[model samples]
Target: MAPVKKHGRRRASVSASELAQMGVCERLVVFEHRYGKRRTVEQQQAIKRGRRAHARFYREGHMDWTRWWRYFIVFLIFGRWLTLCVAKWFQVRKPHHET
Candidate 1:
């Protein structure tokens, strides 16, 4: 009689870009992508943290925490107004359809 052998989970197809996004510490890209493993919130936050916190305000239409919090009391109000004005300046008029 022959003995049976057990096997672990098989590896999935993973790409290098995904591995870079995951910040794979060791040489384990496909393994991590296949298996249930993820980077901590703190780690991810630190890795790409604060870099674009204010990008929302800078880019317009997607405000997160309002990077320009130098003066939360009144400055933000004026700053928001100014930002809106600037955004409107570059706003492209989308054509209205009369269907």
Candidate 2:
């Protein structure tokens, strides 16, 4: 008696992020891949503002900031939290002195 061979089905090659993006808007990923980004007037204005800010910073040696101030604040908070965590870890690992 001859044994029958079973064939496995092949799955489509698609990433989870890509699938999620597609779920949001099917044509968005396709459009991006095909023609690259199409910036809106508001986005262009924002880019121009950022460029001016950057140039001003270079000339003045101080940042004339924008919404990035929020990012800076968030970064400082995250750094503080990380420092506290590391300090706590070291304190826990350090041997206590007996009086």
Model 2 TM-score, 2 decimals = 0.30
Instruction: Please report, in order, the local distance difference test score of every candidate based on alpha carbons.
Output: 0.58, 0.72
Instruction: Work out the TM-score per prediction.
Output: 0.25, 0.30
Candidate 2's residue-wise lDDT over 15-49, tens digit each? 56557977898678777766666779998898799
Q: Backbone clashes per model, in order?
A: 0, 0
Off by over 4 Å in 2: 1-33, 62-99
Candidate topping TM-score: 2
Would you list the clashing residue pairs of candidate 1?
A: none
**Cα-lDDT of candidate 2:** 0.72
For candidate 1, write residues 1-99 as lDDT tens digits. 011225754345544555575584544645554564577999678657555765645667434345444447578789899999988876755556834
Clashes of 2: 0
Please give the TM-score that candidate 1 achieves against the real structure. 0.25
